[model samples]
Target: MATEPIAEDLAGICVDSHGSAIGMPQLCADWIPNQVFWLVIALVVTFFVLSRIALPRIASVLAERHGTITNDIAAAEELKRQAADAEKAYEKALADARAEAQAISQKTRDEIKAQLDEAVEAADAQIAAKTAESEKAIADIRASALENVELVAKDTAGAIVAALGGSADAATISAAVGNRMKG
Candidate 1:
């Protein structure tokens, strides 16, 4: 029962469509001239606005943006050039500093070497003097020891001869002592 009444209402809607607007208004033959005139007016007005106002403004904005990009690129290139120059200067300064450092190091080394040589020479001179003094003192001590040995030997020999009831002459003892001291 519900489907039958709905079907009747849908059929009545189609039959009553002739008394009301149903299809697209623009496709009607009775309104063709008026729609054409309004469409042409709208198209002409849109074209005029886009070409004279909106398009020119948009074009100017694009040109300004392009100019800004070009300027930025040029500025970047200039900065790069400046950076390269700074790097070169830095390298040169570093090289110069290194050279100066090397020169100073060499000078310092030479001075140290000269001082070392002078000190070595002074030390050697002092050693030579001390060695000569030591040699002279040793020679004097050996001579004094030899003289004391000779005197002690003579005294002992004289004492032994006297105890044995035989007299040994000083000259004879002296000759024997000299012969033995030769070794």
Candidate 2:
């Protein structure tokens, strides 16, 4: 059978020399030194782990990551500079091509203009020659018509004189007709 707690046992455990409440043994001063000793040991082990192992690894990783980011940014800037240079080169080449095309166009125009001027000069020469020939032909036709008119006038005069019973003189009629036709 279990023995019941006696009065002596309860009295001895409930009251102590100090006026402190009774609870867990952790509240007692006798455990203070042992708790302090364990606390110090835990702190030393934590410092060693952080400083020698975990913190150095994290720091190295951070440093490596920063270096990678910086290198990537630097590479991007270099690529941008190269792109700008390429654009400038393209613009320069385009300008040069345009200038070359303009020069070619100007040269073609000059050559065409020279040919046109030559053609015009040749046409003018031909027109002048034809005009001179036409003028000479007109002069010849006018001279022949003047001679035919004189001969017709003489014949008419001779016929009229003979019909009036007068002497028909060819030389006299010819002389009179020539004098009238002078203007």
Candidate 3:
């Protein structure tokens, strides 16, 4: 008597008199409205949770990531620009340094050339003076040697004449020696 009402209620909902389900529970017409109502409630709750909580959090994270990426890209571009500028400056400086070095080298070469020219000129002047001095000395030596030779010849002639038992005149011997030397 106590279980009879419970069995009747269960039979009308999803079970037969023996307590087995009447058909597929999902397709049962008696349960369709309740299932549909609860399904709609669950879907609404899920939609609200995603829209109000999960989606916003996901959107914030995505936005933050996008902002970070954008900032990194901008910074990279700025650094690239700076690097290019620095390279240009470095190249300019290198060119200027090379030019300055060439100028300095040329100036140094010019100074050395000038000094060398002056030294060469001084050496040439000294050589010319020494050559003139040497020529003058040679002329003096030749004059003295000629005078000594003339005296020796004259003396020899006088001795030869005396040895031959003939009187020799100094003036005549000198005159004869001078005439022979003229040729």
Candidate 4:
């Protein structure tokens, strides 16, 4: 059986054509330090950029949002104040209307009272006039009755004297009148 000869270069250091070592297991072991250094530099750069640029912009935006919130709160408070003022105005108007209604009611009551008083006065005057007229009529009737009584007495005395065949004297006429009055 035939086997191929091993090359010496496989176990020895390999070099590039420019005389630079191309492969070193030791250099490959040191690559971890270089990668660590570059990672630290990248982290620092990222931190500076965020602090100087992006962070400031974000802070400004947040401040603007806070200002907007404050302004909105102030506007809401103003609106609340306006609403309260409107309610107060409405209450005042309602009170005024009630007062006016009360005044009107009082005036109407006063007018009614005045009218009632006037009517009462008129009724009293009419009653007084009617009473006076009744009294006057009663007096006249009494006078007429007295005159009729006197005439009747005279007639009775004349009849009595004719029946008895004697002359009627003043004394007899007066006695007849006295008897009629007693009856």
- Give per-residue lDDT, candidate 4, residue 29: 47
lDDT tens per residue, model 3, 76-182? 99999999999999999999999999999999999999999999999999999999999999999999999999999899988988999998689999998899988
Stronger candidate by lDDT (1 vs 3): 3
Query: Any residue pairs clashing in model 4, and if so which?
Result: none
The numbered model that scores best in TM-score is 3
lDDT of 1 by residue, 1-183 (tens): 433344434334332333434455545565668788999999999999999999999999999999999999999999999999999999999999999999999999999999999999999999999999999999999999989999998888888888999988999988888888886
Candidate-wise lDDT, in order? 0.85, 0.85, 0.92, 0.83
By TM-score, highest first, what's the ranking?
3, 2, 4, 1
- Candidate 2 vs candidate 4: the lDDT winner is 2
lDDT of 2: 0.85
| Model 4: lDDT to the true structure | 0.83
Clashing pairs in 2: none
Residue lDDT tens for model 2, 37-109: 9999999999999999999999999999999999999999999999999999999999999999999999999
Task: Look at candidate 4 and tell me the lDDT of residue 13.
Answer: 54
Tens-digit lDDT string for candidate 4 (63-103):
99999999999999999999999999999999999999999
Model 2 TM-score (2 dp): 0.72
Q: Candidate 3: worst 10 consecutive residues by lDDT? A: 1-10
